[model samples]
Target chain A: MNTAALHKNESTKPAPATVNQYTFTPRVDIRETENGYNLEVEMPGVDKDGIDVNLEDGVLTILGRVQPDNQDGFEKAYAEYEVGNYERQFQISEIIDEEQIEASVKNGILTLELPKHAAAKPKRIEVKVG
Target chain B: MYSLERHLFNQLSGLNSLINGLPGGTTFAAPEGRSRRDEFPRLNIWKNDNAVVLTAEVPGVDPADIDLNITSDKIGISGELPSRNRAEGEAYQRLERSSGKFQRQVDLPFRIDTEKVSAECRNGVLKVRLQRAEADKPRKIAVKAA
Candidate 1:
């Protein structure tokens, strides 16, 4: 229902809280490393061509469509999961540089590089004696 | 579209709807929206007496590329699924299968000793054995005439 609560939900599928929602969305791991925060999202069946990244204001968003092989009139014995689009939104802080963000889709896991902004980075400045 | 819990609830309501005049009434049918089936890998879960079996259809994953983690209540499979596609020409059409990093976590209903959890990957099928802890095993008591 709530995005904040959805974030805490153990069923960590990245999609928003909707009805009859296809929750095949797998859980993703977001960890903060010494350099920056590393997001390792599990997005299987998504190709590089189908994936897209967008940054607006201070928010970063990733979207990808998982298309299936054409198998018409196929009879399924049973299916416990559903397929569809993959979308995730993250709040970006001043620490991350918007222009320097680089992304790559290897296999299905899309790795996005958010380099630390120059201002957010710590720098040493000598004290000037008046 | 919905949370896994909601999906489960919808499924449960569908199952409940079949039997009318029960505690709950019919809800909505399977409404389609954002489909996540394509987002994650194809995984199957089976239950047995001693342990719960899990298998994931990982076509490109190497045994060495897979990582396994076991805890007191759950098991995690994390690793990179291989994906090196050949260059396509005019004849190339569509690519369906997925590759790259994948991780799956399954929670066992019954408590199991994590130390005893054994896993083996063969033919892209990962078999995890979650042995039930001695304390959680059901014990049979002697029947006495009262």
Candidate 2:
């Protein structure tokens, strides 16, 4: 099966909000199995309560919010990456069982399991010899 | 006795503040064609008069695999990220996450008290707090009228 044809990366602009924090596209790894698809998203500094996964109209959106570190008495000495929230969306095909999808986060990585519908699963047939 | 060290620290602080005061904060030096692979596990540092706190983004890396080496004024971090395990029928559709060994070293503006340093890893981010060495701190001098 051509997996790329099944999933399309949608470049949807984030909704304008009152917050001034920048939004970054988190890196991801997608894997296809016999039963379902697995998605791993990297969102550092984001805890479990800070993530939101939503599926609507065949589009799956993931948002990870990171609270800016308090800089009270400390001065910023150096930085290599900007602190911000994460947002990404993907257009999922009909083969994905959106209702059965499961999402979990650990160690700053979010794993999403998109199970395939029973009808979409491959069927095995046995041949008999006369 | 600590005038030279204080002067050097002030100069470094001024330069760092200038760079960090930009609209988008400090960015990679290269103008274009730069990738995250160039500097795996990017870092952000904050410091006060007595201590410095450093945070690094290292998602999907286990805490046991991370290694830290600290000295009076420098710290080195090295770690290996394990690759995802795949079964027989599983295949990758999109593999943007890189897994391999990475190492980085940073120099602190003030001497560190190795004994007072502490490190912790939570939710894929590593936070290291290093306290300034006692001997390196500026001491007030009393004046006596002759």
Q: What TM-score does each model's chain B reach against the true chain B?
A: 0.62, 0.69
The TM-score measured for candidate 1 stands at 0.43
TM-score of chain A considered alone, across all candidate predictions? 0.69, 0.84
Give the alpha carbon lDDT tens digit for every residue of B42-119 in model 1.
555555445555555443466678887877777777888555433322111112334577877766666777777667
CA lDDT scores, all candidates in order: 0.51, 0.72
Q: Kindly list the per-residue Cα lDDT of model 1 for residues A1-130, writing each as its tens digit.
A: 2211221122234345454444333234443333444454545556778677887776666766665532233333223344455666655666777788777765456667667667655467999999
DockQ of 2: 0.26
Best by DockQ: 2
Q: What is the TM-score of each candidate against the true structure?
A: 0.43, 0.79
**Candidate 1 off by > 4 Å:** A1-26, A123-130, B1-146
- Model 2 per-residue lDDT tens digits across residues B22-112: 1111111222322343376888789998899998888889888999999999989999998689899676656667688999999998998
> In terms of TM-score, which candidate is strongest?
2
Error of 1 at A21 (Å): 9.8
